[model samples]
Target: MRLLSFVAVFLFSFSLAEVGFAEENGSSVSEERLTPEELDYLVNEVGNTQEESEDLPVEVSRRLIEEEAQVIDSGSGFMVIYDPEVTKPGQISTFASIAATTLKLGGTVYKVKSDRSKDDKFYIYGNFQWLKTPSYTLVDKMTIGFPSSSGLYLPTSGGKVKQHQHRYSQDQQGNGRWIDYTIKYSPSNWEPSAGVAGSYDIRASTSKTKHKGYIGQYVYVPTSKNGKINIKITYGHRRIAGTPSVSVYPAGLSITPTTATDTRSYALTLSY
Candidate 1:
């Protein structure tokens, strides 16, 4: 006749104190320490659930006990597990709960910060540690100034094309002239798919153009004379990924008269 055994496991919540001992050779023992709350949650919740299981074979019951002990021993304070899918600020708290549960189950959790801004924040609970994502600048904001002239001068030496400002006629009633400009990006020995290559914003007169996605050749017409073009370019890196360098080169510009025989001159300056 087969023998059936019922396993009764009792879990008591208590503070886990730091314990250290020396081996026979005098080597110190190092182990992960769990907070009181984490220990209480793990034992009262996880252990009690397992204890409620009904009778099973003696071997199966023994195996289950061993497995539970192994799960409790696997947690580490030094190691972190990163989940890149959790990238948004709204998902931080929800993910933190999942991370805490994972930690209780002898798993690891990594703290991650959103890339939106320095002021944007999130927290990881199980580890009870704060981690900050390092900031890196891929492209510095630069401004190109031009003297008042009737013609636009486009640069001949720049990398792949990213943006283009076409020469277009403005309203005859306005004193503005069209300035043709181009923006290009060149990666420094890195794949373009590694991270965001770059982004740019162009502000001229009363108009503002922002580019956050897609790097491609495009034309824009901003009517301005003796006005400034404010340009700011930024690059973002993937979570936990090291900094990658890139260059944003504002190519030269081409000038065209708004109207035939219109000799009105204007100075165009670009700043970020």
Candidate 2:
């Protein structure tokens, strides 16, 4: 069988699925803060899987800067909670696998509902009702590549803590379902105490779900005319930002703009 290129409309199914995964076979339809009963209801029910599809690798899983930790299981797939602080909201998780191996074999994926208007609200989903695709159908086109990332920033030695402006572009297409691009910039962090200057550029992108994504990367290699010359260079950094705000390792540096400055040019500064 071939992979189903499109997914179906997810509606009432979420409620049944959520309850099936919830505690003690319970279903809470009202919108209210979880009481002790509800808390118990949720914690017990969330991320419950079907006892099948337990072995797919997580292609990309990005924990938001201000995201609540979630639980994952073969029956329920993936779940997302909430964070009280550091608020810049987006998806909770993103998961991808070979179409043939996952839903076809016995796995599911869950996406957070954007339109469902309730605080701490989410929905649980499942896939592959008729067993559309098989694992052995497409071995000839198989290739292995790990997702990666590259990042750049302002020169730490410039004493430029000022927030800068920048521009960006993206495109998500084909099976990849992501927007890819190249970025050039200075280091986001500066060590005044040691006077160690650093700068890096990043090329990154994401899919519609944005979690458990992949990045292709190449690092900056510094060139030296003479070993004695102390010149601040625009080299690349291997560590890339996991989200829109900061990188996986932020040493007082932020690559993304807190806000866009000029819409046309798409530029940024060190100090905002």
Candidate 3:
């Protein structure tokens, strides 16, 4: 994607070898605090996928990063913010993908909503649904992804997706209706620690009526180098039905701001 392109060009121009891969066995100590409930939730319902390294081939990683992290053309002197929010009752908000454009001054935080009618599921990040049945409790699936940087910080609110279901039973007025099945939520332990190239992968299953949900969030962290460097973000999510989820391995490229005292233009940095 755009971000991957940015990193590729930045890395190629500077001739910096791509960095090392994060170990599969949960290399980074997550600063995100897990609640007893969340701990039990993860341990009992979901397997710790981050601890097992998938060993994405070097060429595959490079190609996937470039193919998925598309760059946005925000023009010169513009800061492109690639952010997305997911919402629903009982589930954590997540950015299935991101949006980008020039940064607005005094508006460092950007907000965008999900539009199901537009097939804008990218904004939703992962697949979520609430199905009904006669004999069984409804089965709901939850997936979450985390970045590989400590500097990232996600706010408690913002991305929200509401859900509704139709019930055949009639109200006092004798009319069938759509019931609000919106799942209320709080943030989870989703933050990244410093200098880790690996992300968190979480998934869980619960009864549809259990009032349990997952919210995945993403926030950008700023980094700098003496010279030009490619800021490649390694993001991961849970694979569903053996099909690879896009958020499971999303990559992007970014350019760190240059200092005023560092008069060397980015082109010059390429030579050094």
Candidate 4:
């Protein structure tokens, strides 16, 4: 003894526009036939409700999406980051991406061209964040430059041992010359019950060496020209965590002023 209720445009695509009509009490729950403008309004409402609602104008949006953005290092190494999010050249966010990639691949020495910049962030990429890992150290060679370092870490979660670095470059061959100013090897008795879900691992990716105490940090304050954030690389594995197998990856982006703006980059790199 029951009858069914219905809507005519019920077959519309399940986008933001059609959402309000699906609910009974929604504003667009029409008693009369919906006009094209009303339908268009519903569509607009849907677009206005998306999670990516930084809600920039379409013209602004067109300038934000980047395709095949490339930073070519004259040194035969180029870095790349891919996303539809980039919109134009000379964008601040895009410049940050370029700098971070350069530092990780060993372009610690760089220049920034502010005259070439036209946005809020680094115009050509220049921020540098040194890795806070067991294998991280700053070796002061006669030259003021970033000591080739790795952007990886297995940081602890608690205790006085917040961050530790164990990997280092020993004496050349066996001459016994300490690479950095001070080198230390410490181990954590704490064990992590679970591992992190990294970009490299999706499901229940547990570290063989857990993270319960100390933590790695990406907090080097860069203070040089050619913008070199030095690192000290040793020959074999040292021990910041209990096992030497854990890896670290750089974790931040920032600005480093370059030359004539468009002629340089803001190089940033580090790990925590």
Q: How does each model score on lDDT?
A: 0.23, 0.22, 0.24, 0.22
The prediction achieving the highest TM-score against the true structure is: 3
Better candidate by TM-score, 2 or 4: 2
Candidate 4 Cα misplacement greater than 4 A, ranges: 1-154, 157-163, 166-181, 184-272
What are the per-residue Cα lDDT tens digits for candidate 4 across 2-68? 2222243343444545554333221221123334453343235322222122211222122222211
**Displacement of the residue 53 alpha carbon in candidate 4, Å:** 47
The TM-score values for the models, in the order shown, are: 0.16, 0.16, 0.22, 0.15
- What ordering of candidates by TM-score runs from best to worst? 3, 2, 1, 4
Off by over 4 Å in 3: 1-127, 130-141, 156-177, 188-218, 223-272
Per-residue lDDT of 125 in model 4:
14
Comparing 2 and 3 on TM-score, the stronger one: 3
After superposing all C-alphas onto the true structure, candidate 1 shows an RMSD in angstroms of: 29.9
Cα displacement (angstroms), candidate 2, residue 78, comes to: 9.6
Please give the lDDT score for candidate 3: 0.24
